[model samples]
Target: MKNLRLERCGITQYDEIFYNLSYDELFRHETDAALPDSERGVVASSGAVAVDTGKFTGRSPKDKYVVNEETSRDKIWWGIGPVAPTTNNSDNQQISEETWYYLKDLCLKRLNGRKLYVVDGFCGTNEDSRMRIRLVTEIAWKAHFFKNMFIRPTAKELEGFVPDWTILDACKITCPEPQRHNLRTPVFVAFNMMERMTLIGGTWYGGEIKKGIFSVMNYFLPLKGMGSFHCSANMGRDGDTALFFGLSGTGKTTLSTDPKRLLIGDDEHGWDHDGIFNLEGGCYAKCIKLSPEKEPDIFKAIRRNALLENVVMDAKGVVDYSCDKKTENTRASYPIDHIERIVRPVSRGGHPSRIIFLTCDAYGVLPPVAKLTQDQAMYHFLSGYTAKVAGTELGITEPKATFSTCFGQAFLFLHPTRYANILGRKMEEHGSQAYLVNTGWIRGKYGEGERMDLASTRRIIDAILDGTLDEASFETMPIFNLQVPREIPGVDSGILNPRNVWKDKADYDKTCRKLAGMFMAHFNNFTDTEKGRALVAAGPQLDAEADAAYSSEA
Candidate 1:
């Protein structure tokens, strides 16, 4: 039976394979191997294992490919239809079946004579919607990472386990002569949906392993009339659920891992008729400059069975979370059980009562907290805007505007409007309210303005969760038409309206108008259906209001 399963996984030949080893067994194997070579990584003082990703510290989007076969040819969004191009347009690049077979054969040849590590796991927490997955790797630490990131099957549950999908991870090998092979680079991540398999090579970055499956779920779930989101979710004490949607560095993981609430999941989730379910069993949190004072839960959770990637450490195994010597994208991956406050036994929640769209607006023009009309919510959902600060990347000296459709464009399989439409129906069906919270600057743009204090952002979130801001007085902000509350209990009212804190009101208007115009231009990429048109129409009016204000001043 085991050989048959291996044959089914296209593993007809191998020197040896270790299947479904316990956590301690895998950890022992990994550490024993690493003892001789510290470069492979060592156990940190905190009991977490730290390793470095070679060649790349992040995902390679251009090298990611989707097979243009019968299963997903017409379904996948090939490109943004006829608008100004953006970075996200590189998503869902197509590859031929011939190319997939060539790469698959190369990877399997490399794995044939080697000792292999295989792990069996599940992705979705919802029993009905979950996908069974089998991951085969050449390294034990990556097997440990797969175990940490996915829902671990019980001893009895593994009795007759067969995977719904299989991933062959050949992380060390690279494709040769890319031009002849129809590849963007030597490093490639190709998903063949028809075969229910993914092949990864030439990069040791662990994110590619998890996100490869996430991209699959983003394709399959929506076809079943369910919603797959790249956002974080948590539940209040009273069973009220909330979701925080944002791209990286915009505080999605930071805000959702609330000490006061029970964390459902920190990264990806699914919404269906049965409510919300976590797509993974773990949290992958950014740890650059991480401190207990700011993020006590994440700080404390990074011990005993957690895995750290690309973090700097000393000879004594002391990790400096502040050091970016390796990369600013240093990360910690740990199971949800590591958290003190979490929904036990299950990582599921009821339908959301509120959805907060967090944006790090570097221009300092957006209000700290604003209630969003459903149309406005849909607009922002499709826009999915955030800002990348200076020093985060090379050549980014000032705040650079970044946008991802649904805040996860890189992982989406269908057109972005598909998910937006599903979210709209679900929110309306459940009567969920929406809010836009700016966690960026307050007084002026970037260098001139001060970043909003973490305490202030937390207080603003508390007001929303406690239902205190629902009945507060609100006024419409110009240019964007967002309804901003005049006051909150613990937050300074002076910063509530971003325009009020600015030293120069004219500069604020100019910056705000510039941002509004950027929104209008970027949103033009969508191929609008009637519903999409409504969402687009609900966005900021680039000229009418701002033009009227200028004329009135004249």
Candidate 2:
């Protein structure tokens, strides 16, 4: 059996062969090179990984491990060469389906029944150790998910960008067969590595290159996982549990590290039999020439173990930080392994006391923070309400409807109902609850439109933190259509009335007309769809209750 040889830390190094080779040459040798199969079929290159190929007497495909050597002093870090240019045969040069059949054998043959941690990444040794570690761990994760999946390392555009990754490692791991199982997600962490690959990623991605290629960086892992990345924290009441859900922009890292609460995990997380745990060692923040003032936490965290993303630089190559270039994907990705007290492999061991579903609402209608009920949680969860990402020159330009479970859609394999069922059951079982805090806006009276102040939102969150809202009396108020509380702390109870938050009484009527029209379009008018009809039916009753709750008694 071939064992992974590690050298003493800081003492050993690979032969440095990757340094001399041109990117083009390496791609040529790997992708263009061919091997013969016993079935008289020709195949593209095979994995250059070191393994015990002899132990595999198995005949099926399954989950396997692709090791990312971050701490091994003895392991060799092989640098990757540039991608070979697509030629007359680019499309013709796909890896044979049978290749996956072989890949399945490789992964299962190697890591079956062995508790392992597979790191995922782009190209391990293409540039520096920072980049390598990120890419490796990402690869490990992807490899772990798809037993027979063969990952090709490249940052070039093929299909799209993959972000549905978690430094989510396993505990009692076992790979039975890499048999043909339909994988819906990609093990995405690199630039378009999952581009051509459909399942685990998306089609739109970053254009600017980091280091050299747009591979995933190792610095994204939180330090808690015990790696060498940065820019993360672990905060909550006991520091044992916390919520880690957010959109691409709205300060996921910023708020998660509030000095008040201990940080949990970022990027990738898994709900296991025990609890939830993070897979990586650091953090990955989006930066396009970021400055300390704009992102001070991340700025400070980018030290020895950090890998800067597609950041634009000045003549001196220093980051500008203020520039918002839609053209560039200035990013800062790290591994959770960098954090010191990271919660590992967060299993769905139990329900969370508080489940905060974050949003980046551009319409800004609701308050930044308002508590929601369990049913409301489910409602909003199904609503998957989020504004369309402001489309870029290359993407959509307006806010659109995006509803996803918890808030991620990239790598989810199961139907959203699966997560919903889990959350509902767990919340009920644990007596923990769900809340819908509209971190979006406030509708004032008459034509005077008003936006909720962020400070007030913070205060609201603060109140939630101290349990002041819970102690206060809550009377369920209703919106005309939805069962929203008329009075939520840090929120105006008037929105319960259709007339509130509009420019004029006329506007209120117009708005209701619009909402009803939208509803009718979606089958709200049908009595046959009782479930759908019930939603609208719950409207007025919910509004009255909410109004009573908000009509505070001094």
Candidate 3:
């Protein structure tokens, strides 16, 4: 076992200073890191202290312990080193070691009254070591909201913990009273708003998820549409411009901020009285194999305050996004401060010019993008779109499908219907256009990787930005298909049919039947259920007469 042997800080040094227990005894004998003082004891007393391997003397991190894959499976091993960490695939900014200690200092200072510590709680012994350390400091400050931040001690640990829903119901939340304590450091403020107040953290890796940070803790407020979901809505001017929703990889950031179009907000946004206003100060970009060439602007935005997650490291522990062995959300979460329009308190008001939903259809049969009629819009909205996370693909080989309404669930704090209603009402009020764009592979089956030309994708974006597609004559596609005018510039007219993604006509028909079966099955789960039906009823009709007019291979 890799143990912490206190050579300098002696036993009985400050025992029972606050909590009626021996500090030295606790530290020396406890498997748990450091214990917190009970109610009647000392308040948080620790300051920013650097993480060292031992009480004294410098030691080579690699020499202190060995990485034994064959043994020590249950032990946690923190990478002890002296140098400041460089930015990873997910982050472009490197936090200094001094700044790192400030993060611990914040925990020490805030723990006295806090009840939680939001953290990345995935299955990693390395991550757990850090989690334990966070607790040691959390109890010192006793900050009121740090509970549920670390690992659950027992099954019943959740017994009295406030349910996530309760926090959502608490309407007005401001920067905690004295405002956020100015540690003069930028430790990530790990808070969840998707469905409740959750412990959230953003650790830096290689612009990807690394240790213990959760990306899907959106708030749960049902203001409109349907059940709860993660949403990011912000209004720039009249709020009648656009709202982007998609999973991590889909080009929400890329498409929404079309170079020709002005950007309202980048990442987290709250839909308020005026419109959508971004709640964050930065964007968390995924950085697998990221290069200045592929996404120059995003690449350049990383600097100070960005936290990289789960990027493979080099011999020097520097991030290497080129490696795909790590988790899929190899993400870089930086404050929204980088984007110009990010609002304070993250609230805004405005109208939208259009409502655009994005999807990455790996199958590639879908158009680069297609505008929708009212009915068609609702149908596509409910169907949603998903592609497997880069490394998360199953060995089963077939690309798995995940359906989520209004794609950006990682930040939405309301039911899906709530967002849908606001969007629908606003679209009607301002005569906004609704469209769906597919940013995945094209001209090949899901795994073949014979991709759609990015040049064509650019052209499609150009058409959307310039309003060329708005005038195209879109016919209602028959048999559960959205009306796609036969020949649209920037997209191949021939591949509009679902059957195009498959090679043999027989295989095409089988997949279509299977997909249709899934649709029917999911649809059956709802009988007059919430706004889901309203969305369906309001969408394009599956015309019985049109079913026979066109071939499945049309």
Q: What TM-score would each prediction reach against the true structure?
A: 0.95, 0.52, 0.57
- Runs in model 3 lying further than 4 Å from the true structure: 1-240, 315-318, 339-349, 389-395, 408-415, 496-506, 525-530, 537-546, 552-554
RMSD of every prediction: 2.5, 16.0, 17.0
* TM-score, model 2 to reference: 0.52
lDDT (C-alpha, whole model) for all candidates = 0.86, 0.35, 0.40
lDDT of 3 by residue, 397-433 (tens): 5655666545532223233444556556556766767
- TM-score of decoy 3: 0.57
Considering TM-score, where higher is better, how would the candidates rank from best to worst? 1, 3, 2
Lowest-sum lDDT 10-residue window in model 1: 79-88
Q: Model 1 — TM-score against the truth? A: 0.95
Clashes of each: 0, 131, 101
Most TM-score-accurate candidate? 1
What lDDT tens digits, residue by residue, belong to model 1 across residues 422-508? 898899999988999999998998989999998899999999988898889998887798899999999999999898889988888
Sorted on lDDT, best first, the list reads: 1, 3, 2
